[model samples]
Target: MTEIVFTPIGTVHSPFSDPRDMPIQPVGARGVRGTIELDPACAAGLQDLAGFSRIIVLYHFHRSNGYSLEVVPFLDKTPRGVFATRAPRRPNAIGISMLRLIAVDGATLTVEDVDILDGTPVLDIKPYVPAFDAYPDERAGWLTTTSGAARTMRSDDRFC
Candidate 1:
């Protein structure tokens, strides 16, 4: 396989200073607030972003140390393949969260519903359009069994 590299355009800041204290997913992070500080060169890309109610942030889980083919995710007790869950200990340490846009000033974005760790490297941001991104009925695989438990779920160092 060929190697690839990515340079972060910004960092995510949230109350989650420790990986163990962060929300595992957006469903568990409602009302939490955070911000993104983009590099000056990426400031211009923030244009027209304020109009979107929600934005998808693609970031790197810089704190995650290694990969595991199988993991016991937050919601379930059984171990499953890494790709089957949103566990952070993947071959590629990346994370994505959909946050509500509160405001944007230059390249700084104040957002809510944050699930990522503080100082996480941001790879990209995309506006979340309901028309294009939302689906009324979707199958969640094994996650279906623990869907109701997510409201209080938070991440831990197991995957970090």
Candidate 2:
């Protein structure tokens, strides 16, 4: 067996103190503002990061307590494998989102369209280049019909 660990490089500050009724995804959180208060020791890493218009944030799902092999995702009535849905309860409890970058001041990052919770620990940050990250023709699998629902769906206690 092997063990892996990660230390957060920063903490995300957002309006969401509670998970219930929050936007389920970035599309649903359009215009929502947030910031990352990065650890001062990592401030030097921000060099050249401001040039990116969008950044991919990788954070920990700190509030999620445990794992479930299957779950009834907030968007669907049928049960789905944990890996297929973006349910927070998982083996690793990691989360990722693409946020619109507004500015970078020292170790602080201003971002928008954030669906993450306040005080969430940010594990990593990466520039979001559409040429490498986007898949215009990707399949939606079980969410084919309900894909657009994310634009308005809110979070609930289903995964909690």
lDDT of 1 by residue, 72-91 (tens): 99999999999998899899
lDDT (C-alpha) at residue 79 in model 1: 96
Question: Total clashes, candidate 1?
Answer: 0
Clashing residue pairs, backbone N/CA/C < 3 A, model 1: none
Best by TM-score: 2
- Clash pairs (backbone) in predicted model 2: none
Question: What's the CA error at residue 146 for candidate 2, in Å?
Answer: 0.7
Angstrom error of the Cα, residue 51, model 1: value is 0.6
Error of 2 at 11 (Å): 0.2
